[model samples]
Target: MFNGLSVTEHREGDDLLTAGLGLGGLQSMAPPAFADATAPTAPELRRRAIWSNWRGIADLSPGGGYGSVYGSVANVPGREFSALARLEGARYPHRVLVQVPDAFDHDRRCVVVAPASGSRGVHGAIAVAGAWGLPRGCAVAYTDKGAGTDYFDLDAGQGVSLDGRTAAATAAELAFAPDAPTGSAGVRGVAVKHAHSGDNPEADWGRHVRQAAQFALQALDEAVPQAAPFTFDNTRVIAVGISNGGGAVLRAAELEGDWLDAVVAGEPSIHAGATSLYDYATQAALLMPCALLDASLGPLPQPPHAAQSVPQWTARCASLAAAGLVEGADTATRAASALAQLRATGWTDAALRAGALSVGFDLWRAVSVTYASAYGRYGVGAHPCGFGFAALDPRMAPRAATPAERAAWWSDGSGIPPGAGVGIVDPLMAGPDAIPTDPTFPGLVCLRDLAKGNGGDALRVRAGIEELRAAPPREGLPVVVVHGRDDGLIPLALSSAPYVAMARQAGRDVRFWQVGPAQHFDAFLALPDYGARYVPLLPYVHAALDRVEAYLDGTGTLPANAVIEATPRANGQALEAANLALPR
Candidate 1:
């Protein structure tokens, strides 16, 4: 339940949809700035936070059809309600925010409850739920689902207020307050809620999603007092989210309730009866670099600035070979062995091919290290792989964050570190500064062993994984799941496909839309070859949402279960509606 609530209404140039930044501002090269870098106001934090979220969550670049196509940032005047929802006796807080556009209809009330994708702040779904629902006068409900940019700075003894400005850790209702930083982590450090909360927060994502919807109804009762009493029975609630957010809605469906009328989940990272993120991410962190060396994959996206980047992934091939993981005397043979091993594990060629993009960014380790700690329920400074988070110095050594940098974390930090200037660190590294080497091979190997081991840490991790699996969603619930064939991060074969099959086999109504030439990340669609080779997945997500909305409204039926063969855009060509291949 909510501990407290704060409300603010937006009018004039400032509106709910874009956080006062219209399409132009959102499409700007940089995010909106804080007036005073060292001492930002709450409103400044909110606006810039929304701007940062828009870029991370949506593809706002020239080709992906944001403003000109499916989405719009047209000012929708509305009142904003923010609150923290927490289980009893917990320091970590999950945010529930409601945006009630002025156009909200009392006669036909609707709410789109979308949890934040990945580990983002409250506005993370503004690109999806906010864009789609606000214009139609439906309130948008967002929850971090127990993960967010509510960073706790151990060095400064500071956390963030609900509005995201820096505040003392001792302050009342700080978003997060981890156990006092201890155990000699070797550098001034920061803590993220998802990894350090010690609560195995993902285990409770379903509860948090339900709480967000509950809060949305309470907020609406106060926002439109004239309408008074708006309960789940009378008001329509459509739940939609992507990635982690998507998994949350699916979890919510498993609960026995009518609070959610329909669900549209895209690339959901749910651990059904198949491969969980931990099972694959650690494998990816260890073998992807070696696998990328296979020339047969052909022009796969390597890490940005590969020619200039350190860590020499070629060293990774050597490391894997030496560890007896892959059988090969040289890089080429080693790469083939790695690719063969991945295929034997049931990974599709498209998934491995698309995964090179994430491999380049080191996202596999980023996700693995974070999730490993979360699953093991490790507190701050106790990462099983010896990983820590901190702002980096010029030489890439961990350092205390500057006031301005600390002030911007709420808006700039990606919920996960290694973003917003704060990076993953190895406190156990012998040198004063950690140097990039062999792409952090030892750490990845350690994580992989934990996955296959049965130690205390492994037991904890597997136990948490068990908690994340979904039972069949309650009968009579309708669900539309959309996943891209090219999604390497959370591969379609490993996640959505099996879950949908099981739910339907249990006699639940679940629609599956597997889209080709589409990938997990719409934001990455702006990249050069990425834009040319892959279609954005969000448009299909929107199509699913539209169809479900019609079904709920009695205007139409749900789309059939089938693959949608979308077309890749030509090089230098603007994305067009014809490329979507959405079912008629």
Candidate 2:
């Protein structure tokens, strides 16, 4: 194996290599001088290419199917049953789980569910659809959002394949086959797979979701051929999503408002321009510097060298304070608090655990907390420096750039090195009087002007913010947005509140619900052993969904804008509405 060949290749009657040369003996034999040896084989490269393009993996288990849905076991009790539907389009082919009731009224509606972060592709949408859509005699389709597969695939056509498994049966086979009775209800829906999960430099989050929404519409159109018993009401199709998925749906509503009848965004992480700059900068200052420092200078303070390391971090804090990014008085205090926390718990273990949870934290709560705390400060105005600092800090110093070296790098006016990640500060710095000068912090102006010519970073950041901020809901299109008042991750004030205000200002038919004491994951908490500590907010979520469905069905009225104070039972089963207070 070390020689890149199996023992079988050299075995002669089990003797191995030349006669009587076993695996150990073969090590002593030198290769022929004339033999041509190369690196990776053609087959290996081909295998990698195939794996990279593959979107969904095949599941051959008795009940298993594409995108984590099991046809046999995933069926809801008596009311509804599920089957995997393959939707092939010109650009992409996706498999979604379609759940329909045993029987339904002639005017049944269709729902498209977008899965949340960390959800198991189509499997995650099952519970939400079962509780919300299936009971109403609605045909619900749950989208994977590419959670179980490679979400980064640019070419949507080359998705992973799930073939030849008993559980991998198509929708036509289970629901729309000619032999099946037309009287029995069949599902007409599609699950959309997200293009890219993360902040890919190539594409923004808003653009990716817009494309996914378009793909979903195409998928629904394709479902028409497979759905015989059920006539999919595309005119009344509603999109529902939670968390990151909720943000995607909101973007979809903005980009594809004409295609959607209504949108339900629950605890959405909406990006609202530069409003989050300060908070984002604070997090960068608090979390990033230490990690970068530790990476450069071995394990923070090494015994006798503790004093030497303290000054470097102090300088970073001082820089922020001088720039008026952080409160000058609190700089030392905050550093002390962080250092004390670090000292109480050693770096290695805590860092390892933190690193494990950091992905989820950064994606969900990091920026939220940053915004909350930045605005929470006594009297800090809009400071663009924070945004500048957050972008430049990571690349400001090399792993070997010590405290003294950084000081020189900043002082010499050499600017960021050629290969440093794009700097946004430079363009802002180039404009006369772009960055206000502070008498106390003499270095602020120099730091601001460091990236004078590099405008790419600034342009990207600005464009991203503008793209992410959803356009006001289209006229006559009803939008229902539910936000938890106590949501610490993506605060209601920063995300939904502003968006709601914008929508109302534009006279869009929109309803905003503020549920008190309900955290972001409260609905998921209601599930068995899901979130034991959080008070369940699923009942309120159901209430909001009920309103959305009613409005779509044209049978009921939506409540006026109001704040609902919800009280939860200890068992996470029930949520009581204590009071409904109208927004003043």
Candidate 3:
């Protein structure tokens, strides 16, 4: 569907499964069974095998715009075929569809996957889905989150039931197109966004988690309406998301385990529970009291020597307090006094933090403490704000400046200095040179936008894992989790912890795999797309699909090889092996 490129489509009957959809008959190629009960079942492993044959659809045209973005499923040549077949009530099928871009055409019955960001919405995702080599008709379609129309269109095309409670799928079917209306698509589902609410996202963690779940559920409603009804197998779903989508899935699992079966969340985050605006203010107050001392005045040391360095400067402040250069029982009191002075002029933390005064305050130090504290509460006590910033390791945390790093903070020195004292930062505070206006800085903003919109809240969502773990598994259904180590958006380390813990608690029988470093869902991030870092996962997806087919047919065993070595120290060992002594 790429505007400048073209994708070949094919249409055929369901008899193509005999040749194994171009990769050799995997239906008869069974692998050894895994001994570990905590591992994936045979059907799960097989699903991954069948999923690999889908080579993905690519749009290579130039000058294509958003209008070129295509959001439908199609077939591939020399591989598989696709068509809509309505299912009888309560009857599910194991059929699937696949595509090998280099070896097939769109009309071949296999789903044509293409990049959605490039006039190719979910086309690439569909290819990734097909690569699993599901069956002749079973195909994954791409749709817009806002529209929630995938299943609607699919129902019209195939006369399939819209009921989410039923787990029965017919023999299977697939469709493909570019720029399909957000309305109904034949036999295809859609994914929507979920969000939690209540407390301010900046201050309350629970509120954020709920918000994210809402957004994810919205996506699921649109993307996978097949599971809308209440049934055991109806919840056997899989998710592959990036950025906000990544964070949304995590929250969704908490809210609706009924449909969310497996997840590959890249750069996932939850809302922050501990790190809020007040916390930031408290840190600034404790570390850089001078900034709050006088809104009208410059830094206490005048142009606080940037060369003085963060550690040295904070050390100087601490040392000064020790020598009585400043007066107050503790850093907080001293900060409070300074804040009182600033408040007299109605100055807010946002104003000072972005002002020339912030240039003197060491931001790195404050930020490190913030990052460490937030993760610590969740049992991860390491300080990983990145070289000197926060949330660089992914897991949804945003990169932020620490007090030590704030030595470089500067203002354009143009606007009126914000008032003397205020609890939070005013998103609009900046000196004349603050950002030189332009398309970036707005005249007035909220504290949430300045600290890098929703990222902190996203990371905070991890805190909800504890709550999720405490809940009983919905109808004893197993959860499948997949992750790409090379994902820059969601660090492997961040997502690995909770997954391992969840698996450990569930006693295995669940499917958990780590493919090469993949970009959320694409094969490119994974090397060789297999076992190495950044390897493509299409093959594994095929294997997983094979397993799913077996589950539907009652003739499969989970493969040991299905577990692509994720993190070395899986289970609770990593938490126990952590350097910090946890509170029992």
Candidate 4:
């Protein structure tokens, strides 16, 4: 048993004697540590015990956001900080950090912060805890959703290498077999592996996120008693997150709403398949051809699709154009000419005759232009597929020029196809060798379906507000959703707007606020001397948190749902006012 060991024994700088104890060993040691320690109270002992367990597994030094503006609140006076504590997650142990201000209101109010997707785990949540939690005198807990370096191998299986002739042959075959199952003929599963074994098959990404939130809340409950000098009010717990984290909080609310007082999401990545028409159109135009080629040729090739016969290629392009999804006369002309050439000769002959790869790049540009023009007309943002797709393709990682090349190549209209009234093509052609043309298209569609439980996995993870309205309601819990009107990464219309409407229609207490002139990652840009900065949205986030805290405290009225024109100030703060022109 873990006797005589106090939880507070391992302070901020203290080293543990039993650092080698793995998760299993640690679990075997001692009871709950709720018993009184020889040196101090039982709560203090429990805190130290938990800290030791956490530090033994992961680094808790304030390195991630410590030097950045987001961690600036660490300098605030009268704030007590705790080293990250390891908590039991759904499948494995995860990390959590707690912060309590000296002037804590003793109201038992706590805030749980989640990070954005692709973030370096708990590091992503540190700033929010500092900026939004400390100043408000609320206890804060930050948790990583198993995306940290310790939980996932960043470098493992992240490359596409075809060395042997057999492997190369399999790659070539897979390239053409669109319906081929993932993990077949060396196809890699894009889903990153968890740190621990025995993963629950039923737990999709959303379920994992919900479980992480639950663990954090449980850790806070245990840590509060030990943090006696700085009391924490845990009764009013609010979950807040941005981007992927935003979606997580929504799911957490849906799964554990009874325990939460409020939920706040900013530019949440939700409703996966709910992309705009323009997004689907552009993605189809760019990826369909690449997918076709990639399937025919391995990751690297001298000439691809030379032997393959793609008789339906032209027909597909024609279909899109006919559907009015493709715009611009120049683009239409190019599509037509490309189709005509395909009909005259097979994909191989046409490719060799016209430099197929370059032609594909040209088609990408033309289609992208049409998509962009349509985006502006429709007032929707471009799908964030460029980044998402790059992450999926390991080749893009080694080739630094790949991402820039993709952006520039698609934007510049150099390789337009010449012809008249070209017919459109269907990106998702169905059956064998079907082209996946959507931004949300999973390369290993079959694998995704198997892992996610169905084709609606992405939507399920997003936990869209509209979808939530149809679920069993969590009575009395209010939700405040904030979005940046200028966020091209996750457009407001496709994400938060629909949820707000759904909640209102369901008679749920939901408020939506759109912040203009602010884009995703605005808060990160707030850091002084941060290179390549954009408009900072930290001011708006802070304001939103303030409003949420007020609502929780029953001391202020919720602002009417509307758009706020946010103007960035010279001092890095944003000036926000109600925009009457925007529809509520």
Candidate 5:
């Protein structure tokens, strides 16, 4: 919510500001600017906490997870800045040395530092970067919890154990339970941990998940207290997160209530119960086994001569239905429709054998292995990216198949019909399956109980946001959400849809910014030295940060563009280039 700072207003022409690094400290450069006014050298820039080497950065969100290296920054005398990062932690990992103002703290009010989720033990470098840029004076503080050992899996086989969802890193296991500490003026921050693994049974996973959430909340309590010295009453805390860590912010508020004032979730994955969004018929007619070919086999395989000897795969739905695992008229019809579609779609023993054996005699065998391992019950049809129907059908060529093709593939009443719903599915599985539909796609809909479930905390976040808008201001909790238009992992539409609706419905003050051409990780991992032609990430960050400050001060308005542009740079000089637009 800090909106006081401006790149153009402060920096003179031709000066590069301190840009953050990307995954593994990958370096990129912003274009040379033509503006004016030099900041004073050694202009009494105040020093805050020190950030050392950030090891494997855990870039997590509700949708999925990735890792990165840390970027380092020292305060510059003037209001300009520079920094660098390594792409994938390669030896020389793109060291960035940039400059920014020492007074650049967001809102110049308070700085509350939060840790990346699931990064309790790992160094700061492993944590995902914050969604909004930090203002002068405000800096995130990091702690070292030793690694090489799985923190969440500590009591994996022993029994269900719980960690406090305390962001302050100072709550008692039971006391903090599941929320970020509340009532603070300084910047509010939290340390997040990944929720229970897939192996954890859905039945009794809440206790452990709550414990982890409790830890995150406790961190908030420890990091920024409400007392006089801490002055949490003065500054607003920005909730920055990715993957499961992002979910943690929502969970903490859900369980603890009124903890985190504002939040930004990346690749957010909210869970769905029992059924899926895609109907059984749709899966059969459109979701072919061949679709899994590339992700499983690296490339397509050929057919074998004695294909009958090769095994054929029926989706888990068919098997479950036959074995009485799935019952009821709706489910049975769905299953039967899918099976018939598979058979008619040429998912025969011969096709399987051929694709399996094209490479070698054991090619078919390899295919079967992939079927069970990769496309089995647990991991199938979850992400939109992996969803069989969403893939571009090469046969269709340049343009995707029209409604006619879909009609041909779709069976009347047998499959999903026209508007079957595939509820939300698993995080990694949702991308492949997420597709826009008239009445919305019928597929797996994942809905987690925020503080209790393994993931999908976004839905639970509604209550907290509502409560905040109704309540008086504890501090200026400015919230700015940035998402990539073409993020393959987690579509930007999903992230912004609920958020925008919520803001409008509640009439609350929040800002939403969408970056174009930028995919999931690409948007966050931009630097200033890659070159002029490359895209500039700082502008996006700056814009959002400025908005955050302004909103807190009640002086700024959200920008009106699908993708906000930064100062122009030549293609040759740009380090990373991508333009994203907002969804209609």
Candidate 6:
């Protein structure tokens, strides 16, 4: 089932949870250094990736409980087994890693299946699952769910090894080696698996999770022959995750029940009801800049640079008016019209206000563009909108990635380009940035048009969107879900609330907890206004896992489904346990 599998042990301060950075290193904004910057070893890449992914996914603020509350980056001695595991006939390999801690109990065998959040690398869940499971002596199984950070630079003839090594494009069985064009310009751009693999990988997230769990049991048995016969019957297998990882475990539960005992999903980016991310994200990409201008929203959180973008947003409003997407005689009226459109499209009042964070960070454009390719199954450089990814020169034009950039692709990339220095290429938007007239506008229009399902790209994207909604988990699987009420990315109304209702109606055991004043990005909580206005959801994620485990262990009953009404740590005040209002 596995190819080129290898095992190695790590101990003595170089641990599983923090990769030897300890709490201090993770807190630092700068990345860990490779002794050889141009060519990082597989282990070095792994450590830096862990640090990058942990900071990307979780809030590590001193006030938000880095050292005091739950984060303990102490040395966790363990053996790690990793390899390129593939689905039947799959063109791309999904990477899975199983970490077996030395403290794992032969009798109290447990395995935690944690798929990566979003399109992150296999370490994406290091913050949520690794931090929680490694200390409890549970062997943690992690998969990128077929979408990983194995990037390809067609211009440089370079791609990445599954072990995080830089390799030639022709190397066999690299995680994602796309078909390079004969003429360099034919494919002279960066390629990302999630957007360019033509796999529509989201369709197989459940199977990927199942594969990780299977590998976990096998690896655990091999790591400790004394526990050579571990199986689901004897060992407790729980699935825990957040964001896309959260959606994956829920999908796994639906695909199979017996192997998965219980599920704890936090702010899952699921499609259960009337809305899908592509539908809303594309809309937000077009409308949010103008929508944020609504006077009712007042002075919400925004970076200092957001003020500079006001001219771009004003230009966006004028362009929308010209295109008839909104109606107005002036910017303020057009902004109000944009706000109404958001409400009409199912965005709630809370989400509208909280969306300022994503808007400020320019996430709406990044997400809409990435998912458009995934859902439409568009291959590298084939985006109907003429969107492409490449490393930018000082001139901001596309250029080949540097050797140092290639070395860190696996460690620093978010499994999507237009990041880690690979910016998006839009043919219609001139100067890329020097012109600076809302360069995202043209690409966003193309994505929004594709959402309408008239052309071939639109039809393909809609079909893929249909495949995203997995049925509620089968009866007998107990589920505990925790969602932040104000989540703008995957709003509660669009995702969790409807899924919970459907799951209960289907007779599946499910408990839902809604935490107010909590938004989607826990990592964003470390930001200035964000720290003041939002509480971290990771603590509640751990809490939900605890409830599900206690119920599974017969030590306690499942917490009743209820609203948490969590308090925000406003005005620079430090966060407290009371802020969570965790279900007891």
Query: lDDT: which candidate is best?
Result: 1
Instruction: Candidate 1: give the clashing pairs.
Output: 303-360
How much lDDT does each candidate structure score?
Answer: 0.84, 0.37, 0.29, 0.38, 0.28, 0.84
What TM-scores do the predictions have? 0.96, 0.48, 0.33, 0.49, 0.38, 0.97
**lDDT (tens digit, per residue) of candidate 4 on 1-584:** 00111123232322122222323333343423323222233233323333332322222222212123222323233322222232244233333444444454455556555543332334344444445665566555554443322211111222111110111213331101112243343322221112112222112334444444444445444555554432223356667777656766666655643566677777765542345322322443332442233332233222224444243344444444544533324434535444343333222321222223333333333333322222222111112111111122232222122222221211111111111111111122333544444322222232222222334433432232223222212556667777877554455665676666656666777778787655554323323321122234444455566677777678987656767763343333332222112332
Question: How many angstroms is residue 452 displaced in model 1 relative to the true structure, after the best TM-score fit?
Answer: 1.0
Model 2 poorest 10 in a row by lDDT: 1-10
lDDT for model 5, please: 0.28
Pairs in steric clash, model 2: 54-160, 55-159, 55-160, 56-160, 279-370, 279-371, 426-451, 426-452
lDDT of 3 by residue, 1-584 (tens): 11111122333422222122333222223322324322333232223322322221221112110012211222343322221211222011111122323332222222212111111112223333443333343333232221111111111222111111111124232221112232332212211100111111112221222222223233333333444432323323444433333343344444443444444433333332323222343334333434334334333222344455343333434433553435576544554554554444334343343332343433323322233233222211111221111112123222332321111111000001110010112122234423331211222112112233355533453343233222222333433445444433233444543544554575644455555424332322111211122233333444454554455346864433233432211222221112211111
Single out the weakest 10-residue window by summed lDDT for candidate 3: 407-416
Ranking by lDDT: 1, 6, 4, 2, 3, 5
> What TM-score, to 2 decimals, does candidate 5 have?
0.38
Cα error, candidate 2, residue 117 (Å): 4.3
Regions of candidate 6 where Cα sits further than 4 Å from its true position:
182-184, 304-306, 431-436
Error of 3 at 293 (Å): 34
Of the two candidates 4 and 5, the one with more favorable TM-score, higher being better, is 4
RMSD to native, candidate 1? 2.0
Each model's RMSD to truth, in Å? Answer: 2.0, 19.4, 20.4, 17.2, 19.4, 1.9
- Model 6 compared with the native: what TM-score? 0.97
